[model samples]
Target chain A: MVERRMPSIRTTRFSALAPLALVAALLLGAPMLRGIGAVQAADGGNTIESVAIDTPDQVRITFRGEFPAAQATAENFRFAEAAAPDAPMALKSVKAEGRVVTLTATQALHPTERYKLEVADPPISRDVTPSPWATLVTLFLSSALINNFVFTRYLGLCIFFGVSKKRDAAVGMGVTFTAVMIFTAMTSWAVDTFALQPLHLGFLQVLVFIGTVAAVVQFLDTMLRKTHPALHRSFGVYLMLITTNCIILAVPLLNAQGKVSMLEALVLALGSGLGFALALFLMSCAREKMELARVPKAFEGLPIAFALAGLFALAFMGFSGLDFFR
Target chain B: MSETTERPPGALQLLFNGIVSENPVFRLALSLCPAVAVTTTVANGFILGVAVLAVQVLSSLTVAIARGVIHPRVRIPVYTIIIAVWVSAIDMALAAFVPALYAQVGLYIKLIVAFAIIISRLEVFASRQPLVPSFWDAVGMGLGFMIALMVIGALREVLGAGSFFGIVLFKTKPLLFFALPAGGFFSIALLMAFFNALERKLTGGTAKPAAGGHHG
Candidate 1:
């Protein structure tokens, strides 16, 4: 009787967990589900993406991935009528040379009015949303507030959670982290552009970037141990662990891909550093206050901290997409 | 962790310990970053958890095999390098052969090198244990972490996004807070409490309180 009952109990347990197991199995199949032909947009092979209108009479349309000559035709390019969605506007002429396509409207185009340019062949802009390209001011704002590495993206979680308990420790780690990030970004950018790009050693990015971070952490550890013993004791180990922080490595990778100039790279690094520090500072203050609040037995410590972090993240969501004037 | 082991248990026991008794996220509270970050969706959580599982297993095997050779003083750096090397290799392989999957979780694959859980497993178990035990231990811990991540992801998705694995389950996001980063905290925290209570009940209320130290 006991043995028979045990089997039934085991079966019940298995049944209870079946939904979880099935969901996990389904998730594992996600790549294949989203894999082939998921979002293949049909755009004509034309090169023009979007036209920038300063004044609506003439606009400069840019082509991507090719030179703009020999593709577009006057008949192929038409602006939709102002009121009608699909009706083409009367065109004076369409001209293309080099990588620029010049569009001239017979009537002055409304600068504020919505206009869609129909092209027989167009670049894949319809399918692919271009990265919010970095400008000096935009990069600074984006990294520091909008696309903050910590509050927004969840990079550098290890330090963000661990050292962000005490205010002093948090401040110490944040300042050190900012300094290290700037230095490493500069160094890695120099190496990547001067040697790696020139030599076409792009495939070696992971190795080079990680190697640079590890070396930077080690060097910084030694320097701080000798120079600032007290600071080292507080969050210096956290500094050494920066070797493992994803922010340090990810920044260099972004810099390599972003193709920003030296000044831009430095600005981005500094902005990201400030952002990280800001996150740590805010989290630390919140955690400090959380100590005095009423809390459940199980929800104390890291659990509460994590919950607080989530709240902060929700708050940070308000800062998203604060774009500059293009 | 070693202090609790007076005698080495069987292979199955080691497996059970990882999934339940010493879960990397819940029991030990290591690698909280990925626990909160990638678990926004069930699919994402599974991908990163699998990546972590692979890295953990390989790192454990390598560390266990080299335990005798690696000097005590230099072992930490050596383990970190090994982890970084393995992670880089995996990242490249995924990008080269499985671009589709890479597109989903590639940002996470490189980040695994910094996971304190991987290094913690080495320091706590793999460094002192034999190869086979270490391998089993890693597999168990990896699975446990994966399960925890998935559970958190499912909750957040089901509540925050009104979806499961990006599938719209409900028309309205029931509690949008559950989907945000703050939602991540609530899910993990609440789920952790439930798990703690369940563990206490399973042990007939004799279980010692969980030491909330998660410094790793």
Candidate 2:
């Protein structure tokens, strides 16, 4: 009876996390999914009505209804060549008006080779509203890996380099950073949604966001010093440093700029914080090992560390330009 | 920034120090994040460089003029507010006048508020100094930043994209790796190492462990 009950509990836990696992699996499949044919529209009415090759460099796509211009940017369309399916066509410009989107390639499309056009986003943008879960998951994963703040975007290097020298410090700083990032992101989102946006004071975004982050960091510093003295001692100074941290500032600014929902904002913050933490941890481990190795005089400390980061950035590049959800 | 005498250094000396000895990117290692992010292209880097220069000068001027009134306890916040104001003005100007360049660097323009270089200069130099010296220091630091970024941007663009300031140089990219985000790291690392070697050669001093590590 105990064994049977244990299996039942395990299965229940698995079911609870099933969506998250599915999202990861889908994210991993993005590169492969890029080569696959167009995802059939949920509502057949919204499917591509016609695709005409107007010129060597231009492909005109028409939809059933007025294709929202917002949904017709270059990123929404993917083009593949028959000769080299893996190589995406380089688009010079994309113009959308009424029901038409005209894509102009940088070079003339080969007259002989067949080509495939996939409208990766617009159909969903128009017809099937992305569920909140999907939006949240996409933002989270994209921020964490595909568009990693530290590796790809290069935000927060001062703390990233300063604390990542030691494993223990890295872990401590990473935790403090994530907690602070989430709290700050939440506060900024609230201020943005309630105070700033309604007032038509968009110009105040930089001032307000920085002020909010600074206020939050100060509040956290005091609160931690009192409540968690041990933890404060470990990473207390880092709290003050968090004010000028590009990552800390970037998250709230990004959230405001994107006009993301609150939950989506939270997920973005969590993801970016985790991504930065991951970068720090990996660099610390590598740096710790490098301390023992022989090094040239010029590339002793930061130079070698940056070299290591360059390699890591190369590895992270695999995640770029991936389409997570069809 | 330690002064040997009670008197401040001359303007030329200050400018020389910023451009060579205490270059923000290669020497001080301040604001490395934004430096690398915007240096992907010469044009982008130049635009950001100009923006940073303007902010640094404006903020420094503001801080120096108002330093007498600003309390020591709240100087950091005051400096920040001043920086944010200048950055927002630049951001708005770029968006209004040069919308194309603004589109590329709009996010980074807003990000200048948090840059360690501008804030550090304000704290270390501007807040303590008189208006003229502060102005010169800001220019020196700003010029150093701009030059460093332009150098990195030119190298990256030439190597990565086979272009210099959007003018195609090579028929094909010399090394596509130089254009990617990874390439940004490598470019800075290589240039930093090279600068270190050059400095050591010129100064006849013992090799110094990376100064970039001290920031943030």
The alpha-carbon deviation from the true structure for residue B106 of candidate 1, after best TM-score superposition, in angstroms, is 1.1
Per-prediction TM-score: 0.72, 0.77
> Any runs in candidate 2 off by more than 4 Å, and if so which?
A1-127, A321-324, B1-5, B205-207, B214-216
Q: Judged by DockQ, which candidate is best?
A: 2
Per-residue accuracy of model 1 over B108-176 as CA lDDT, tens digit each? 777787777898899988998888889999999899999989999998889888899878997963787
lDDT tens digits, residue span B1-216, model 2:
243246777899889988878999888888888778888889999999999999999999999899889998998889889999999999999899889988988888899998889989999998788888889899999999999999999999998888999999979637888878889998988999898888788878575755755453
- lDDT by residue (A159-191, candidate 1, tens digit) is 787788888778667777877898899989998
Off by over 4 Å in 1: A1-134, A225-238, B1-7, B165-177, B200-216
lDDT of each: 0.74, 0.80
Docking level of model 1: acceptable
For residues A3-30, write the lDDT of model 2, one tens digit per residue: 5456535543453355346547755654
Which pairs, if any, clash in model 1?
A46-A121, A46-A122, A310-B181, A310-B182, A311-B182
lDDT, candidate 2, equals: 0.80
Best by lDDT: 2
Report clash pairs, candidate 2.
none
As a whole number from 0 to 100, the lDDT of residue A226 in candidate 2 is 92
